[model samples]
Target: MRGKLRHGNVPLRGIAIVAILLVIAGAATASATLLFLGEQPSPPQLAAPPPIPAPGPEPDHALRDGQPGEVGLNPAPIAAAQGQLAAGTQPSPGHPHPSYAGEVSLLARDGVVVSRQATGFALRYADAQGPELPAEQQEKTQNDTIFDLASLTKLFTSIAVLQLADDGRVNLNAPVADYVPEFAASGKQKITVQELLTHTSGLQAKIELWRLPPPARLPAVLSATPQNPPGAVYRYSDLNMITLGVLVERMSGRPLDAVVHDRITAPLGMTDTGYRPPRDKLHRIAATEFETDPPRGLVRGEVQDENAWSLGGVAGHAGIFSTADDLAVLGQALLDGGTYRNQRILRPETVRAMLTNYNTAFPRNAHGLGFELDQPWYMAGLSGPHTAGHTGFTGTSLVIDPGSRSIVVLLTNAVHPSRTWGSIGPARLEIAQGMALALGPPGHDG
Candidate 1:
């Protein structure tokens, strides 16, 4: 909790973090230009930077496939993307990797899979000299291998709330206390569901609910004192989603996982995605941050988020693991304006509304109803006036570019061992940029 956004009156981190991201983005753009013109740009300079720490072992699979030379995309999408990307620039070693490494990925203009490759191992233990990967019996990570989608869980909760609103079952404008009466405790009666989705709630984040005893979780959550006036600023609190999970259970007459499965993942055909992964399926799950706090030792197959872990591995803000391929389905569902593979997860209008900016007053937060939008930082080359995505604290990122009709997913275990190890910023950018470099831009929808 001490590492929370230094200020409570506003959103997580700072507005300047956005600006700093923009500056780095500008440099990446410059690098793209140099590479476009046939000049190789220098690799990003890391000055004795602490190792790019990751949870579990280094993803031995990051670069195992789909490198530019190894994986070639269909010419049309690649040509368009190249032209659009080549604007006022020349081409260089475009689809390259940072020191942390990344998988080469490709998504179609229509969200169809055109290409994919896993160029690296999924575990350091698999390295020729390191030792042994997680388990030889475990399946090696392919481009389609499922990843534990960490915080992407919030998007599902947000969409569920929107679906309820569309059916007139819930009101975003109403206070949360309307359904969860005790939610009004601690002067939170004025907070609306919309505020929770947008993270404008005044809840002080992260009270180490997991560290506290079992019975204390509820009181600690209810006792989360406000750092500022309700709606005064934007502070991302895991408590917001936890409360939302509780609300879903109360409103839907079932557990939170049931609502998500019945309404979201199942309908979307995200077969490999969910909370409380099955015992038999553990071998396929990638290892994430190894825990020490609760002294759980190596964390594999379970949710990686601490707050989500505290809540029985199912919460609003975190606690969902998914694979890149499955997420592609979800991302395409949104890009299709709510329909995917003939199934509809949401109406087009609803999808658009979900992606609309609700945090104009809190530019630092720059969030859509539940989605973070146009963030150039972790968004990498996919960033633009219309790029939208969100990053999980556990080294995962998703960037969608409406302008290009593209989506890039980068799932990593940067927090594998501990939260330390500088940042995965470069890897995020390279992953998105790699996809951008491959796809170029779109012409028209068929």
Candidate 2:
């Protein structure tokens, strides 16, 4: 401890003590510098991560064949619906004749096809006045029987227009005249494409385009005028869709039928759906009304609407024929937000827009683009503020209920013998009600 220091006047022991103190001081300084530099002196304890939110319920599965019980449906009602449909093929006391000659119905819930039934005959009448076809020559309704969709064709036309809008090829808010300059004539300059879609364009409900010479038909529709001021009221008009069909053709540079097939049916794998189905498919096609004015006999495998026939089996208001299964695919596609079998024909937003009620000004007629919304007259028990569907004059009806994730497709040849047959409203109500009842209360598990 009394030894001398090597280079300083301090004793060796004192020097050792000072060195120790300095070393300790340096360490403290280094720690302070680290602190000043925002370095952690030690790894701090971390908080437990917030609990991950519980996983939401599973999404609906893809459409497939399933029993009623598997999808929370009561089979009794579904069977009853089938019974009613079968009964409809025979004459009732109130009505001396059948409500419809034949029908094919498909019902699905949560993407499961609970029932697909075919009843009666597709080709029953020999003529509009009667004389039943020989049983040997009659074609029984099949699940795949193609039916004339009538006004339901408007839904396709609407989809085509919306697709154009989605592609940025057409503007929904733009005037029709902007796309087809001839549409501007006769004070139609202000009629918007949306107006046409929602049936607010004030155009006449229909015109005898068939009466006009074939060359004049298209021109007449292009230059047609409004019956009332644009958006003044809601009047469902074939002219609207007819005009839109022309617009689709012009914008897509393809025929309307081709566009629907390539973009819609083909993508959905709907093989039995199209305008002017191939000759090979005629055997599976349902016969519609036997017309006299046009002198079309036994209208089998041909369009039922006169104007559509006059237009070469392709028109917006009516023409496309389809089977129940194909339409069920379409309904599911919409329910799944416009996709089926991995094919997306419309964006989810476009689907939402198509389902949204646009005719708030006209309460009685709630329309969404081309779909009739909350229409109880045809939608029956499934009718709701969000339920969307359409009726074809050829006795076809499609009901898609978003609330329950259900679809009902009732395709009938109600006009097979004649258009004078009574309304198929009762049958439409029965099937839809059956579906609604089969679904039971919400949150019910099979």
Q: Tens digits of per-residue lDDT for model 1 on 222-331?
A: 65667777677878877887788788887888888888899888987888888888988776666554577787766777887776787788887787878777777777
Q: lDDT score of model 1?
A: 0.59
Q: After superposition, how far is residue 206 of candidate 2 from its true place, in Å?
A: 0.6
lDDT of 2 by residue, 85-194 (tens): 88889888777888899999999998889999999998888778878988898889988889999988999999999888777677666788988899999999988888
Model 2: weakest 10-residue lDDT segment is 18-27
Angstrom error at residue 257, model 2: 0.9
Model 2, runs deviating above 4 Å? 1-61, 442-446
lDDT per model, in order? Answer: 0.59, 0.78
What does candidate 2 score on TM? 0.85
